[model samples]
Target: MKTTIFTFHPDLKNGSRINASLAKAASEASFEVRDVYRLYPDFKIDVTAEQTVLEASDRIVLQFPIYWYQTPALLKQWFDAVLEYGWAYGSTGNALRGKEVLLVASFGAGAEDYQLDGRFHTTVEEVLKPIATIQYHTGLLFLEPFITTGTLNLSDEGLNEQVEKYLNILSAE
Candidate 1:
């Protein structure tokens, strides 16, 4: 199956460490990776182009670092713009039906901090619930997310291991 990854990092080429590495690995493995921020610096997404790519791919992976406990601004914009009424969610919107969406997120805090009584008082899955709910509206199958916690202190070896895990998921049927 054809899998396409949309990476949403505002400073992926510079500031990001984990996200950059992940994208690099995916690209090296011959996956179609689109750097969304770099593609639309002005935040003017080409809905037609994005929808075309999504339609062609069997799996759509959204890779990004969790910022403020949510996705970056541009990603939200992409969702609002690309997932239109008639094409993504209305009664006639079935263009994305049967497609699978996987969210790969990196969190600065450790996994321990995302529990019921943890620092954030919430789980990683809980934090991602809003985004996952997209499936109910669009018919896109929501896959269990791949999350890497404690990104702020992840070692090179750990990052490499995470990359391997991410690639394995992508390679899975």
Candidate 2:
């Protein structure tokens, strides 16, 4: 199956560690990894091109680091611009149906900090509900997300371990 991972990081080359490593692993494995921020610094997404990429792929992966409990600004813009009503979710839209959508995200805080009684007072599922809703509306099959928390201080080995898991998940049926 053809798979594509859309990576959204504002400054991936310099500002990120774990996310960059993840992208590199996917790329090295021969997966199509689109560094969205690098491609569209102005946030002007080419809807046709993006939709084409999505349509051609059997699996679509959205890779990013959580910011303020949400996706980066450019990713949000891509969703708004590329996921059009008539093509993605309207009555006549079914292009994304049967496709698998996966989320690969990282969090600055530890997993323990996302529990109900913890610092964030929420679960990862709750934090990512909006993305799930998008899949529901678009008829895409939502796969369980791959998330690594406590990204602020992950060791090289720890990050590589997570990357291996990510590669495994994306490779699975």
Candidate 3:
């Protein structure tokens, strides 16, 4: 199956260490990795091209570092521009049906920090609900997410573990 991982890191080169490694693993493995920030720095997304990519892939993976409890601005912009109502959704929009959607996100805080009594005061599920909602809207199958917590200070082993896990998640049937 063709899997496409849309990686949206604003500072992919200079930011978090995890995002880039994940991209590299997927890219070197010959999986499709769409670097959104690098592809559309001006926030101009080619809806047709994006739709083509999505249509061709059996699974769509959205990878990014959680920013302000949400995906980066460009990712949001890509959803707005590319996931059009009449195309990705709506009664006539069944192009993506039977496909799978996966979320592979990174969090700066520890996993505990996302619990009900933690600093963020919300569950990881709560923080990631919108992506599932998108899956619903698109008539796509929603898979469990591959999330890594405490990205601010992950050891080399921990980071590699995440990269391998992410690769596995996307690679699975």
Best by lDDT: 1
In model 1, where is the ten-residue run with the lowest total lDDT?
Answer: 13-22
Q: List the residue pairs that clash in candidate 1.
A: none
The C-alpha stretches of model 3 lying farther than 4 A from their native spots are none
TM-score of each: 0.98, 0.98, 0.97
Evaluate candidate 1 by giving its C-alpha RMSD to the native, one decimal: 0.7
Tell me the whole-model lDDT of each prediction, alpha carbons only: 0.95, 0.92, 0.88
Candidate 3 C-alpha error for residue 71, in Å: 1.0
Between candidates 1 and 3, name the one with more favorable TM-score: 1
Off by over 4 Å in 2: none
Regarding lDDT, does 1 or 2 come out ahead? 1
Report the C-alpha lDDT of model 3 over 1-173, residue by residue, as the tens digit. 99998999988988979999999999998998899898988998988999999999999889988988988998889889888888888988778888988888899999999999998899889988987888778889988888899989899999989888877777778
Model 2: weakest 10-residue lDDT segment is 128-137
Worst 10 residues of 3 by lDDT: 164-173
Residue by residue across 74-128, what tens digits does model 2's lDDT show?
A: 9999999999998999899889999998998899999999999999899898988
Positional deviation of residue 141's Cα in model 1 after best superposition, in angstroms: 0.6
Model 3 / residue 62 / CA error / Å: 0.4
lDDT of 1 by residue, 105-168 (tens): 9999999999999999998998899999999999999998999999999999999999999999
What is the clash count for each candidate, in the order shown?
A: 0, 0, 0
